[model samples]
Target: MEEQTIFHIINNMDKVTNNLIVQWNKVFEEDLGVSHILVLGHLKVHGKSRPSDIAKILGLTPPTLTYLSEKLVQKNLAKRLVDDSDRRIIHLGITDKGIEVVQRANQKGVELRKRLFEQLTKEERKQLLTIYEKLNKSL
Candidate 1:
């Protein structure tokens, strides 16, 4: 691809992402921020996970994860679990409330995506999906 095309694609992708985030902030009524929701979503998908592992997977520092997890625990959305065999090891797990929140967040995300993509034809949406998948694989 030419340099101009590449720059245009990158710029538009950033604009689209920022727009979605702005819209999400307007529509999402939760007190939690994106990082907190990311941690909860990770727990929802992987069940109980060590703080270190979660931090690594999420590209966050251990202390940052601790800060985010603390908020979740305080909100009763998540809990800390001590390993039975290893008391030194701590894991975080999502609570029932956390699951509910994740579901609601996902629903909001789906609705936002629908609204944003509604302007495009179905074929265009499919093409965009394919392009994104390819780009993700490259990463």
Candidate 2:
């Protein structure tokens, strides 16, 4: 691809992502922030994980992770635990309440996504999913 074509595609992708985020925000208006929801989602998916590992996975700085974690902990959505074997290491996990919240959020997101993707044909959706998986694996 030409540099111009790549740049255009990148710009278009950014717009699409931003638009979806805006829609998601509307659906999750009661939540704290997308970052906190994202953190909870990660913990929900992978179970308990160290703060450093979660930060690395989420492409966040330590301070950013700390801020999000603190907020979640205070909200009673997640808990921070010290490693049983390594006292200094901190692990973060979603609480049962957090699971319920994540589940409801996911349900709402799925409904929004269904409406959002209604314009796409099934074949297009399949192709998009394949593209997303390929891109995800490349990272």
Best by the lDDT measure: 1
Candidate 2: regions farther than 4 A off: 121-139
> How does each model score on TM-score?
0.90, 0.81
lDDT of 2: 0.88
Q: Where is model 1 more than 4 Å wrong at Cα?
A: 133-139
Best by TM-score: 1
lDDT of 1 by residue, 1-139 (tens): 6999999988998999888887887888988887888999999999999999999999999999999999999999999999999999999999999999988988898999898899999999999999989989999
Checking candidate 1 for backbone clashes, the offending pairs are none
Quote model 1's TM-score.
Answer: 0.90
Least lDDT summed over 10 consecutive residues: which range in candidate 1?
Answer: 25-34
Global lDDT of each candidate: 0.94, 0.88
Question: On a 0 to 100 scale, what is the lDDT of residue 80 in model 1?
Answer: 100
- Residue 88, candidate 1: how far off, in angstroms? 1.5
